[model samples]
Structures are given as structure tokens and as C-alpha cells.
Target chain A: MENPVQPLEGTTSKKVFWSALASGFLTLGLLLVSFGVSGVAYAVPIAGVGDFYVEFDKLVGKGYTFYPKMGKTSSSDSAPQGTNIIETLTIDNLQLYKDFQVGGEWIRVKITASKPVQISGLQHDAGLIEANAKFENLVLEENNSSDWQKQFQQTSSTIVLENAKLKTHYLFQKTINMNGMKLTVERIKK
Target chain B: MWWKRKFMLICCSLALLVSSAGLFSQGIKAEERDTEGFIIEADRVVGSGMTASLVTRETSKNDGKPMLRFQYNSATIYGMKLTKQVHSDKGPVSITLKAKGPVTVYGMTVDASAISFKGACVKATETVPALGMENVVMVAHYMKSDDSVIDQLTLNTVFGSVGPKKPGQLKVLQDLAGLPLEQLKKEIARISAGHLPLTCEDGTASEDLSGPIGLIPNPLDEVIGGVTNPLDPILQPLDPVVGGLDPVLDPLKPVLDPVLDPLKPVLDPIKPVLDPVVGLLEPVTKPLGPVLKPLEPVLKPLEPVLEQLEPVVSETTEAVEKTVQTVCQQVQASGGVITKELGLVLIDEALAKKVPLNQVCPTNSSVTSIVVKLQESLLNTLGLGNLLGKLIPSDPMEQLRKMREEIAKKPDGTVIYKP
Candidate 1:
């Protein structure tokens, strides 16, 4: 009876090992197929900056502030204290959504704002964003401060960019959760 | 082993679910929404708190359906504001306020303190009610309704007026719209009797309206009557003149018949002889017909070329005539001897004056004829005519004469005498 029980346990161990190996192969094959077809599962997320200062020549969506207490309090802060301030806003193209429904009635809402827009202090969270971007005369500065949050509280952060353009569909102050996201930067062939 | 199988199944299911979600997300990203019928463009447009003037024009699509009932050419709104508030005791409430300038609808321009709009749904089953207007003043230079034209309109709550641009135009429009209905039915009854008295309202009778409209007297008919009415007096007097000449012609016919009767007897014998001559010529012409038939197609393309050259040929002929007159006057002033050296000098003078060589001494010009005759006389006087005549054959001389005759017959200068 001891010999029979040892043989049974050995058989069960061999079956379990084969099952695990097969499952690993199946999962790897599925991952490969999905990555090959969708081509978006390999993107790296962007880490948040401490001071959160950015400057672009054009931005095409709404702007809002998450930390109202740290906002600018100078005389030039034209907007209400907590609200986001746009320095020089220009809207190039506006499209009305004809079929937008609200409370069982169609309300004409202009939803699409295309290009030639400018704003200051933009905060955004996007699951996926595709853009044709150009960066000119870019300079990166690193703060040596140990306490990064203290820098924002001391002064209003200012970044100046010249002749920069970024075209994407991501909106400010909106969070989207997508299965996968891809960021591809390819040099245009003349 | 049972736990390992369950684990494997769960892993496979998770893999399938993730891949399916990826594919579905890709599809959603790639999908494009359809926006048809309407397009709006503006220099500056705000999503809310928009204040701008609007100019709208009505137009139809190629399929005879209204694409956009109203198209705004310059409707830009800026600085829109919307506010929303909520209380613990009460629910939330929202308010939107808009301020617009002058609005142009169709051909009328309206200035109002407040204007409201109701946008219709895309489906035909739904209808949107119109919002009311306040303190509106509509001014139109010209307003057209149905087929009638209102020249100038100024409408307000207190005063309104409509009239034609000219005094007589309103009467003309009234007559044109009203007369056709009753007159067309009467004319149709007279033209096609026993058929149902043609009603203008019927579908088939509408097609027959063109017949009555064609019969309506136009300016061209009045112009024709104006031209023929004056001729009536002149033509009436000629009728009596013709009647008075008929008696004089009758008396002469009786007297001339006696003499003409003897001539007819004399001329009757020549008719048989001429018939045979005409019969002999027919065979020659019959064969020429087939030869000429093939040339029609070849000459048809040349007709336009010849027509285009006609004016140029006439202008060239006039230039040649002018040049010959000038040259002849100079030659006659030089005593018409036309020595070879003198001829060369005259040609150099004409060239200096920018006269074309062909026009200076055109091939068959009277000046050229006189110059040739003088040259020939000079050669004969110098005793060289016999020697030159011996070198050139007489056939060439005869051909030259024939070419000169052909050029003289067509004096428009279109022909080029090769000889």
C-alpha cells in the first residue's frame, strides 16, 4: 500500500508541472498576439514633475488648478484666486455638436476646439495622447532643493517656450483609463 | 493537479479578456463621427456667453433638399458666461444669458433688443417651437413672396408699408398673374373643343399653359406692326398703279403678238438643233459629276481656311493698289523709260520706305505691265530682244500671257501667278 501511494503522488506531481508549463506558454502567446495586433501595450507613463511648470506656444483645452492654495496671488493674477488663468487665449476653430442631448432635449454645444489656442499653467491627466510636437530652444533646469513642495509655495512658477506646437486630443482636468497606450516618435523623411 | 488545472484555466481566460479589450479600444479610437448638412466658421467663437451679429442665407443642395435651412456668413460670438448653483434645501439651477447685435434673416434686416431661437432635432418626427421676439424692426429693400415682388418694405409694430419700385410695375405684375388663369382656360376651350373645358388647376392643363403664353403679344409683335403699318399707305397706292398699267400692257400685248407670232415660227426650228447640242454636253458633265463628288470632302475643310484668308487678301490687294499708284507716279515723273539702273534705284527707294517687294511690283499690276513693256522696248531698241527671245521658248511666253489673264480676272490678289 505504501508503494502504490508513492506512485500516485509522483503521477500527480508530473501532471501539475505539465499543466503549469502549458499555461505559461498559452499566456505568453496571447500576450505576443495582443501586442503585435494593437501595438500599444509597451508605452511608459510620464512621471509628474514636482513644481509642475510647463510652457507651450499653443494649448487647445480647458485649464484648472488642483491645488488652489498654491496659486498666484499677485496683481497680474486677473482670474479669481483659485481659478486657472490663461495669459493670452486665442481660439482658431470651433465646431458645434449638433446632436448633444441634455435632459431629453438636444442642446447645441460647441465641443471641438481645433488648433491655434494658447494658455498658461495647464494641468492634464491622460491615459493616451497622440500628438505631432515640436520643441525649439528647450532648456531643462533642476532644482537642488530637498523639499520640492516648498518651491511652489514661495513663488509663482514660470516657464517660457518659443515657437512650440503640440497637437493632441487629451483634455485638461479629465482622467481616462485605457487598456494600453503607445507613444511613437519617428523622424519625418523628407 | 486539480488546483493546477483551475489555475491554468483562469490564466487563459484573463489573457483572452485583456486581448479583447485591447482590440475594442483600438476600434473606438479609430471610429469617425459623421457631421453632415451644416458647417459653421467664425473668426472668434466662444462655447458660452456668446455675443455676435448673424447674417443668414437660405440655400438648397444639389439633390433639391435643403442642406442647411439657414447658413450664417458672419456669426461670431465671444465672451459667453454660464453659472450654476445649488443649495442644501433646493436642487441645482443653471442660467445662460446671450446678447447679440443686428441679425439678417433671408433678405430682411432686423434690429431687435432680444432675439430667441429654437433649434430643430435631426429627425423629421420632432419639431421645435419658435421663441418670441421683442421690439423688432425689419427693413427690406426688396421682398419676394410667391411670384410677386414687393419693392421696398419697412415694418414695425406701429407702421408697415408695401409697394412696387415703380408705379406701373405693380399693375403689370397684377395683370400678369391674374389674366393668364382665365384667358388660358378660354383659349384652350376654343382650340380643343369637346374635350373637358381646360381647367388651369389640373396637372395636364399646366403643360398646355405654354401654348397660351406663346400666343401672348410681345414687344417683337408690336415692333413688326410698327414697321408694317407705314407700308400700308405706300402699298395701297401701288395697287391702283398696277391696275392702271394692266390696260396699257394689254393693248401693247395685242400689237406685239402679231410680230412675235412670226418670230416664234422662226425660233421654233432652232429648238431641235439646240436640244441635240444640250444632249451631247450631258455625257461630258455626267462623268465630271463623279470626279467632282470626291473633291467636295477635300474642299470642305479648306472652306474655313479660304474664308479666313478673304479679309487678308482684300487688304493685301488694297496695299498693292496703293503701292502701284505711288510707283507709277514716280516712274511717270522719271519719263517712263524704265532703264535697268533706274528700276534698281526705284526698288531701293521702295525698300527704304518699308514697302513689301511683292506689293511694290505685284505680279499682274498695271505698273508691272508698263514696266515690262518699257523694259522690252528698251531691249529691242538696244538690239538684245532677238538674242533673249532665241534663248527663251515661245511656249513660256504664251503661258505667261495666260497666267496674266487669270490674275487680271481675279484682281483681289488672292491668286499667285507662278509663271
Candidate 2:
């Protein structure tokens, strides 16, 4: 019996040490979640200025906002703002989720794609329109690895308003990949 | 050692299970709920809303089977949606969508072919989408019911009328053909009832026809509509008027009646022969009188000349005929053969001497004798008395005779002939 078989003193200590190491690794992993963590923020200026003016500025800024002599913008917001600037936007790898404007009028948005795609829905006022629109000649682009990690593929979308009051909620969203894709959005007044 | 190994395997299995659980649960909520489907082939977005349908391109490999897609943003899905909510309705249904710019709607039914549509700007109500640039709008009403669009009225920007001009009205009216008069009246009445007047942004009234008219593309002809013909109005009432509308008189009838004027001679003294009513050829015959008169004076000298030359011509003709007859008789007499080589040599010698004289007749008997001898030699040499007979044997008579003889001598069983 070799001195009545002294209890194996080190078994519990070995088990405790291994358990502690496993817990430490788990904690480190929790602090550094890696896959699928996106730092993309999709936001449009909504409040500070009037709606159509914002659209007009966006059109002027984006270079797609043009006023037809016959078609008129909303009667409100009399500030004359016209620029020949061509609005060029590039989406690195992020998707366009919404079109928000703070004011009283319903505005129009124009979206051009480099490649053809099936648009999922035309949403306004939070799921107001149940139908969808398909567009041709949509511009799409891929993300460049040398760019910032948050850079995404780009895409474009657009819309316009007829009798809608400014500041109305006009939001749009789509699911897409951005390894390399792009789209452009422009506005025109009616 | 065995127990330790078993324990390690158990721990590994639990770790695998725990890690997989965390990985599998880490999907985006939006993507998880997204019901993406077959790619949208084409769509028309009207106003600000999107109307997309599954499209099989003119070059798609889908074999006529339509695949549905969503029309969202600027992209459409190809047929794989997590879930779908189909909205179907009966009766009059109208859907209003907000669209950004000019857009089109494309769709197909379960048992129907795909069709595309554009929004018709309701006169003062809606505006037409422009070209080149993009526009925006909220609330494009898509009326999908058969009777929902009873009548549509649009403003005539070009003509500035309540509606389009005569040709335009004719176009719209032509579509009403085959419908009963009562039906036309009923349709018109219905249109008038539902007619919505249009106004410009400045609030100017365009025309009175604004209210009772629903302007639509002429189903028969694509033209704007309106009319002015009185008789045409009875057939297709583009415009209606009161009873005094009887034409003051047929427009074609002149205001002054020649019948009532006595100053007009009972009959003109003489009607001019130059009247166009007679014929346009009157001037053509005018030159004939002078032309025929000059022909007499000119032909008089020609008659004398012709008479003087007649005897000479007759004598010359007689001489020529006699020479031709002599030559023919001589040729026939020489065994119907003339020595062409001797004739050619003589002609060549005569021509070399610059004599206009040619062999109109054979001058030497030796030439005729030579021709006859040559003919005899040729006939003998070619084995030909009759030329046609010598050239074409009559079915090989000699061979026929020999063959008949051979047939007579054949052994009884020598030939196995098939019929």
C-alpha cells in the first residue's frame, strides 16, 4: 500500500490552472469580436434646413438636382440656389438605407446604377409603398483594400416629389455586398 | 492515460459546440428578415414609388417562365426570398406610390403575359415626367381596376383648347366605333360625370371641356382628341350645339344667286370656243390647219419628183429582178451548186482592182462545171445522195436486218430476256 497511498495532491491544482487559462482566452475573445463587425454609418442630413432646399442643395451638391423651366419645386423655400456642380458620390462597401429630409414637402430622389439590379421596394413613411422598382444602367463599384477598413462599395438612388409637403419621411433601404460595388443618387424638381 | 484522453475528447467536443453556437447566432437582423428573390428584369417607377416585377430579359435563358423579383432601391433580387407576402385584390383598386423620377411599372399575372405601364398625367392633377434629367414625386396612383378609369382628361398644351383639335378628336372618336349610340351616350355621360377639371400652377382655367372629358390615348389611333365638323358631331359628338346651328346656308353655295340676276344675258351671245370645258387639246388642233396647208405646197414638188423617178425606179427594179432571176436559174441549172471558192476569188480580184462590179451573175461556164464536179465528188465522198438521209441513218436498217436474222438462229435456251 506504499505508505497508505497518500492522496494525489496535485490533481485539483492542475485542473484549476487549466480552467483559469481557458477563462482568460474566452475573456480575450469576448473583448475582440472580429468577423462581420462593420463600422459603416449611413446617414443623410434631415433637419437644419427646409426640405426641398435640402434636396436642392443635395442636388446641387450631388450635381443631379436640376429644375426644369416647366416643372416647379415647392412654392416654399424661396432661396434661389442653383449650381452647375456635378454631384459625384462613391460608396465603398456600405448600403444606402434611407433618404431623410426634415421639412414639409415630399421630395424626389434619382438613383443610377452601374449594373442592373432588382430594387427590393420603394418605401416612404415607413413601409408606405409595398411595391418595388427595377432600374437599368445602375452604377456599382467595389471597395479598395488599400482604403480605410470601413470603406464600402457604393450605389446610388434618387426620388422627386410632386404635391408632397416638405419634411415628409422618405426612406429607402437595400441589402448588398461592398467588396466592390457603387451607385449614384441624384435629384430633380417637378 | 486512457481516462485522461477520454476527458480531453469530451472537453474538445463541448468547446466545439459552444463556439459554433456563438458563430451561428451572429447574423444581421435585417439580412435575416430580408426576402430577396429572383432578380428584377425591368420596372417602371412612377412618381416616387418603385414598381418592380420579375423580368426575363429579351436575352434571358429562363425559357419564358417568369421569375419574380423585388423592385427596391436601384437593385432587384434573383429568385430566392426567405418569405413573400402577396397582395391580391378584386374590383377597383388603386395604389399610390411615391417615386423619385420617371419610372415605369412592369408586371405579369399568374395566367397573363407581362405588361409595362406609364403614369398618365391627369391634366392639372399630374405632371408628365421629363426627359434626360430625374424628377421626384410622392403619390403616383396606379388604378388597376377595369372600370376604375372611366374617363381621363388631360390638358392640351399645344392647341390651348379644352381638348385636342379635330384630328385629335377623330382619333379618340374612332375608338368608339361599333359601340351602340346609347352606349356612346352612356360612356360620354359617365365620363362627364367623373371628369376632373385641370388647372395650371397659376390657376388658369384651360377650357370648358375640362370637366366632362376623360382624355385617353385613342385606342384605335394614338392622337389627341377634339372636333369641329357638324355632321361629324352627330356621329361622334366632340362638340354639341343648339338648334340655330343649321348652317346659314351650305358653305359651298355662293352668296349672290346668279339665277335672280336679270342683268346676266339670257344666254351669252356665243360661248367661246376656247372654253376649257370643251377640252385641253383645243390648242393642239390649232397647228393642224397651217400644217396641212403647207403640206400641199410642199408635197406638190415631191409628187413630180416621185412621178419622174417612178419609171426609172421601175426599170431599175425590173433589171435587178431579172438579174436575180437569171442568177437563181443559173445556180439551179448547175446541179443546184455554185463553186463558192471560184466566186470568192473572182470577187476578191474585182475588189482589188477597185471595180464596183461584183459577181451578181456567174460569168464562166468552167466555174459552173467546176461547181457541178465538186458537188459530185462531195456526194460520192460523204456517201450522200440526199444530205439529210446521209447525215441521219433511218434507225440503222442494216443492223435491224442482222438482228432479226440472229434472233431467228438463237438456241431455244440461250437467252434469258426480261420484259
Candidate 3:
């Protein structure tokens, strides 16, 4: 005998199938929009406490198109080969006009200061996307160079790096600075 | 089973449609407007407007404030900035957009004192033309909101448009020009007294001499301001020159006195011979003498009246000078921003004073306004003659009427015009 439960089971099955498909499609659509355009290139999505970044570069319509990144990275200056990359992140874009302030992409630094300083996003601030936009658990790459260690020991603030930009425009990027003790330079080691 | 599957499909479609509609209804309510974005420059066509893309989002915040972002090449407003939000007269974010080409926007409301669209043209629900993908037409939309009086629509352009598209613009102009000559004088006096009340030596307001209905004596001004006599041009400029030579001529008086003193005695003897000749010529001039003879008796009584009026004229002159100072302060306080409506009133007041107002009221319409000029030299003598050029439409009566409507004070003591 066909039981009444049979119709209920079939209806339940259909409901699960449709709902899953709808939510899956919605998530996929959002990912496609935020991450990259077209299937020509794959953009690596990076998330932070209060920021999100997409990094990729490829040929589009016979031209090289660059995707979003935390900021512009440049290799310049006299240090042990790639050591000058840290100093290049000295960003001073939206500060003031009187002091020859220059505009560029985002800057990063690694430090082991006297205090345990932690930079985080303000809870009340709007306009920021969730998850990857928040720069969470940020750390620098480690390097065991003896000379670099001595330099960090002598002066914790000096990181003399150069970059590939000379911009003097205004900026509006807001972020909290960090100063911490016994911190690891996890990303910068590379 | 097939029917149930089809039902799910219909349900999904309906759900999607409802969600889309809900999302579409809310415009950049919470988001900030960035005006610095979107610069329209000449496109690749060498003389095209610009290569720009506009992205708008109607935020759910504050019931919707549309956020507009623009990326462009070859435009004056560069980069990106958080623009001020704009509101519609009907309601907040009530603007609607219709496009013809690749021009796409996500939101409608703008927030700014002036939404400057250098190449873009904007009106209520205008169809944006597809002038190629790169060309952008930017127009700055500005509105000083007044929701209380929706019927009185006015047109304003930050750059190149008339006051408003509302009806009665011409009627208002006519109304301003229609102010009677005496009424215009009263307006000038009222405006001046309101700003700076002419005070007596005891610090009382000069109510009689320069008040709203100030018995402003014009006897001296009629003569001083008008070129009634033909010899004035030749003699007026020489007065200052002769006064400058007084000290030098004073020393020569002693030498010239002796030479002229001998002729006086000879001239005295000639007067006896001239008396009979003067009597003989009396008949020829007797008709004018009889006609004028009765005026002496009438004039004898008016001598005291005329003498009494001299002080009034002098007092009026002092009050007028003080009025000029007060009026100038008011102009400066308003940041020297002259409205075309106020300019018409100034023109009428200047013309009435016979204060050589052609420099300010240069338009022929001012002459065509009213035949009678004001008796007081309020505007022209006040050195406000240059301000008449700022009047709009050239019709004095219409501008005055417009001013009356625009410059009315709110019960809360705020201005209606620039509010």
C-alpha cells in the first residue's frame, strides 16, 4: 500500500534539492564577482580584520590587466638583495600637502617593539566587506640573517626600502598602526 | 512528481523576483556620495566628452542615500572622493534615471551643494544618450531644498541655466517692475533704515529725515544732482581750480586793489547817467515785471519756509550719507553677492535720485520701467550704481516682486531667498 509518508518524503527531498542549489548558486555568484573576472586568470583572495584584497595579473584583450592587491610592491634600494622591500612600504599618501607627501599602494612593516601593540579594526566603522577584508592574524616572514638582526636590535624603526612610484595625490585609507614585542617577521622573510 | 518539480521552479522564480524588487527599491541610503570620482574629458574621438564609468549603489542606511562612484580618464574631477548626499524635492532619493546606451548607474540620490557634471546633462528622469562607451556627459545638479512650497518651482544652475523651470518667472519680473515710483522710494528707505538708522546728535533714529516715510527734503538735491543750468559744466570744474589759486591770488590783491580802486570812483559818476537810461528801458521789461511783481509778496512769506527747509535739506543730506554707509555695510555683509531681483530695486532707487544711474541701470528696460524717479538719492548717491548690472531680466517691477517673494523673512527670522 502506498503510505501517506511517501508523498511527504518526496516533497522534502525536492525542497532540499532546490534550496541547496539556490544557496550554492548565490555563493558562487558572489565569489565570481568579488574574486576575479572571466575564467582567463585565477585571483588569490586575501582577507584581513577590516580589509579584503584580490591579487592577480593576466593578459586581457591583448593588454595586461592587474587585479586588486593590498597595495603596490616595489623592489628598490641597496640592501642584502631583497631586503629593501620592507622600507618601500613607507606610505604617506593622504597626510598633508605642505609636507611633500607621496601617494602609493599599501605599505607593510615588521617590528618587535617594547610594547605588545596590536592593530585592529574599529567595530563601529561601516563600508568594509566582511571576512577577507579584515586583516586578521597578520605576521611577517622570518629570516635568520645575522646583520639584519643586529640592525633590528639597534634601531627598531628604521626600515630603509625604496619603491617604483612617485605619486602626490590625496588618500583616504584608514588603518590602525601596530607596535609589538617579540613579534615574528613571517611574511617579510620571503 | 513532474508537477511538483515545476511548482518548485515557479516558487524559485517568484522568490528571485521578489528579492530583486526589494533590492532595487533601496538606494544608497547608508553610503556616502563621492563627487571626486567620475571625470568627463574628451573621449578618444579627439573632442568627445570623456572616458568614464559610474557605479552607484542605493544603500539601505537612512532609508536610502545613493552612493555614486566614478572612474574616468581625461576629466577635471579626478580620482575618488566621498561626495555629499542630495535629496529630491518630493522625497529623499526620489530621482529616477533613464538611459539609452552603456551608461549604467546603481543609485539616483546625490548629496552636495552642487553636483557638478562637467559634461553630463541631468534633469528629472532624462534618457542618457549612448554617445559611445567612452564619452560621458557630466552635469552638476544643485538644489536648495524647500519642501514647504512645492508649487513655486524654480530653476537654478550652478553653471549655465536660468533661475528655474517654474511658471511665473516672467510674471515675477513684471511684478517687480510694477512697483510705483513712490513705493520704490519707500522700499529703499525701509531697507536703509533697517540696516542703519540715521541718528540725531542725541542718538535718536532719524525718523522724519530718513525713516520709511522720511519727509526727505529734495530742494538742494534737485539742483545739485540735476544739470539744469547750461553753464554748470564750464563753472563746476573751475571752482576747485580757482580755490586752489586763492593763496597766490591773495598776495596780488594789494597791487590790484589800487589799480581797481581808481575805476570805482569813475564808475560811481557813470551810475547817475545810467539811471535815466535804465528807466527808459523799463517799459520793454515791464510786462515781465508785473507778472513777477505779485511773486514777491508770495515769496516773502515763503522766505521763512525756504529758510526753514535749508536745515531739513542739510539734515537729509547728512542722513543720506549715513544711509550710504549703512547700505554699503549690508552689501559687504552679504559677501557682495548681488541677486538680480535686488538689483532691479537698486536701479529704480538710483534713477529716482537723478544720481547719474546710467552706469548701474544701463539697460533700456530701466528707463522703460516708470517715468517718475524717486525724490531721494538713495542708490545712485550711495555709490551703488555699479550693482544694477547684476539685476536679471532688466524689468525693474518684475525683479522687485520676485525680491519681495524671495526676500521675505520667515517667522523664525530666517531668509526665504538663500535658505
Candidate 4:
């Protein structure tokens, strides 16, 4: 007799492993479907749902090339003084949504942007990431400025999603008052 | 012991899985649920056209004071409503943020025309853009309350580009132009009993006729009629001639000099003895040296007596004249003996004047007394008392006899009948 609980333990262990594997597969499946749908043209994600920002100086006519390194200050005089080193922001992923499913068949589209990017003026006091765009009607998730510079959020505003698909002239008029802020559209995954 | 440890491990793993699943579910649930902190409403655009109005019951905090601030009230673009707890410690504190309302925003971007904070406010910023639909004037009136006190300040805003676009503006101008004409007519009727014409920039009938509504007529016009004043040009007194001269004229000096010189011959060498015959009676004819003169002293006592006698004389004269007139009138009226008697009495009165009173008076009295007696005698001759006594003979027979005697001594010897 080789310990009576051996086979029983093995069977139970096998069941547990299989279940964990199944759960993992299900998560992967959901992610793959979302990725596939995101590949569709002119699609932007509804912003205010997550903590993310994107900034770009050049307007995207078609395709774009993104640099892995942080952007440099356009004006050398405005560069931070002393040992204050510029922090880098990591843009893990990028996607676009035109009419993505919110819940049921009711689909809502948003002009969105991915990749956490800081505004040019806000580079000195890092910790701010902005992305913005305009559409007919936009519903935001949250705008919390609790943690800002000196708790003094020197950052102008952090936009979650920016829709380049919107009318350029109209967007300025109806949406954002971009007095000194620079905006950029990120490249979608091919 | 190993088996027991494995069992514990499995139990912990199961628990962790269940908790993670629960957490995910809660997250999804939160997404679905509406937030109480979030507010939404409608705001009116105020203007001559469509106006956006906002009315709310919300509160906020300002400067450590519990201030009711505007968050996302009626159409957050126009005004703000307080939805969550806002805290401010120091410095000029204002937490004005925009929140979405019920209405769906359409087109490119929707910027507010203006943002105003009312009640207890530190500072309010306003940006009047096209927040609502076009042609709609947006008014964002914010009333914030600080420390339980609320003061309302309204921000009125209008939309539309610069310059006039509609026909209505032209109508306004036309109406303004017509105003003066109507005013002119009203002023004309109001001034001068509808007689004087209007005298504004738009002419008048004649400036001369126009007087203040109720004023004394111009002395110039009344004195020298017509508008072409005679005193205007010709015949006007010289300004230097009349200016500042004294108006008094002395009574001592003659206005003009006497015509003749004092040295001129004054004699008229008359026909000397041509009337020698007239010199004989010159003594008689010469004035008796005021024959009543020596009588003046004697008459001094009689002055009052004379004054007293005057009324008698006047009354007698009036009575005599009245009696004579009455007698004559009666006689003329009757054409009988009464006329003859009145005529004779009048003649006797006239004759008494030719003879001096001194010559006619009895010499027992003084000269003045004699004059008085003659005057009294003249009254008797006039038959005034006799006539009056006869008309009303209610007197005693002795009085009648005296009156008859008075009537009998007349120079004409006229007989008077006593009643």
C-alpha cells in the first residue's frame, strides 16, 4: 500500500490545474477579441475609464513613427535647472475605437488616444499625462486632480483620449481651449 | 503533515480566486451605477432670441467656509451647481469645474458664452462662446453661498457676431427719426393757445407773434404796433443824447427867456383931456377903498357867525331859488298871478345888490352887522321863507304875519300872500 491518499490527491490536483488553465485561456480569449476589434479603422477608446495620457506635436495625416525615448524640451531656456532630471513615461500599448460596444448592442464611439504622454510645459513637474479629442457627445469616467504638483497640479489638463478624426477647425472651437498645449496622435498597432 | 500543508495551500488559493472575482464584479457594478456626486440639468440661453436660463438648489465651499459652489447644475456650460463636498483652506479659493448636463452636446465643441458665480464669491470668470445651439443667447447666473449667506449675481450674455444683420434694426432707426416730427407737433399745440407756430429748427410763422405761453404782451409791440418797429432805425432818440442824463428840471428858472427888454418905453401918452367931462364924477366913481374894509375888524367876531350864517345864506339861496323856481315853475305851470309875484321878487333881489349894504342898513348895528342885515334883508326880498311857509302853512298866524312882513319890504313892492 503506497499511501492511500496518493491517487485521490493526484486527481484533485489535476482538476485544480485544469481549472486555472481554463480561466487563463478565457482571459486571453477576451483580450484577443478586444485587440482584433481595436484594429478596425478610425476607432477610439472612451476615455476617463483609465489613468492614461498621450501628447504629440505633429498632426497625423496617415501613419506615424513613435520614439521609445522621452521627448526633449523645444525651448532650452525652459529646461529644468540643477539636478532635476526629466522622468520618462512608458506607453505600453495603443488602440483606436470608432463604435466600440459599451454594454449591449448600443455602440458608442469616442476619439481616443493611448500612450501616457506629458504636455511640453508640464515636463518640469512630471506626473501628468494628457490626451484629448472632440466628438458629438463625450462621456468621461473621472477627472481627479488630487495628486498634482505640490499638490498644486501645475499640469494644465490631462486628456485621456484624443480623436484626430474630429474636424480640426471645429475641435478647437467646440472642445478644447488649447492656448499653449501641444497635442499628438499615437500610432495604432499594425 | 505534508498533506495538511497542501490542503491549507489549496484552501487559501480558492479563497483568493473568489475574492478577486468579487472585486471584478464590484468594479463593473460601479461603472453601471450613477454617481450621486455627479449633477446634470438644463440652462437657458437668454437674449432677445432664445435665452438659456438656470435655476438650481446646490451648495459649495469657499475659503474654509462651507460655500455652495456651482458644479454641474442646469447645463453646466451656462452655470454650475454644487454636487460634492469642496474644501478650501487659504488664498482666494474657487473650485469652478464643468460637468455634463442632461442635453446631448452636438457638433465640434461646446464652449460656454460666459461663466458667473453668485452668492458669496471670491472671483468669477466669464467666457461667452456658443455653448448652446446657435441663435440662442446663453445667460449663466451663478449664486454661490458661503457660510450660510447667499447673494445672487447674474451674468447676462448675448450671442451672434458683430454688426447688424436683420431688418428689425433698420426699423428701430426709422422710428427714432419720426420721433422729432411728432414732438414738434405736440410742442406747437402746447405753446400759445394753438396760435403760435412751432419755432424749433423747423421754422415758424413769424417770430414776432410768438410770446411765452402766458406772458404780458411786449411793451414795444403794444406801444408801436407791427413788427417793423418805428423805434428801430429812424427817429430813434440819439443814444448819447439820452444816456445817463439827470431827469430833474428846476422850478426857479423859466423854460425860455422873457421876450421884451426891461428898458423899453412903458408910456402910452393917452388922449389927456379929451375926457375932461368924465373927471367931474371921478370921486364918486373911484373905488370906495374896499368899502367893506373897516368892516373886517367888526366882522372878526362874526366870522364864525358868518360861517353859521353861510348855510342859512346857501339854504336860503337854495330855498329862494327853489321857491322862485317853484313859484315860477308853478306860475309858468299855472300861468297866473304867482309868476308875476316871483318875477317881481327876483327883480327886488337884483336891485338890492346895486345899493351897498351900509347904505341900506339901519345905523344901530356895526358896519359888518349892517352887511349881515342886508344879506338877511335880501333873503326876505327873495320870499324863500314866505313861499315855503305858504306851501306848508302849518305855522301859527303870527309866524305868517312875520313872513308876510318880510315879503312886503321887497324893492319891487311885490305883495306876497300868506297861507
Which is the leading candidate under TM-score?
Answer: 2
* Model 4 alpha-carbon drift over 4 Å, by segment: A1-12, A34-190, B1-419
* Candidate 1 lDDT tens digits, B96-158: 111222211222111111112211111111111221112112111111111111111111110
- Estimate the overall C-alpha local distance difference test score of candidate 2: 0.30
**DockQ-derived CAPRI band for the predicted complex in model 3:** incorrect
Better of 1 and 4 by lDDT: 1
lDDT of each residue in A61-141, candidate 2, tens digit only: 122221101111234322221111123332212233224443644344433333322222222121121122232222211
Cα error of candidate 3 at position B178, Å: 95
- Every candidate's fraction of true contacts kept comes to 0.00, 0.00, 0.00, 0.00
TM-score of chain A of 4: 0.24
DockQ by candidate, in order: 0.01, 0.01, 0.01, 0.01
Q: What do the candidate models score in CA lDDT, each in turn? A: 0.34, 0.30, 0.31, 0.30
TM-score (chain B) for candidate 4 is: 0.15
TM-score of 3: 0.14
Residues A1-190 of candidate 3: C-alpha lDDT, one tens digit per residue: 8776754343368888899999999988886564344321132212122221211111011111111111211221111111111111222221111111125333333223343222222111111111111011111111122232211110112221111121211122123332222323232211
Give model 1's docking category.
Answer: incorrect
- When 1 and 3 are scored with lDDT, the better candidate is 1
User: Which runs in model 3 stand beyond 4 Å of their true positions?
Assistant: A1-190, B1-276, B281-296, B330-416
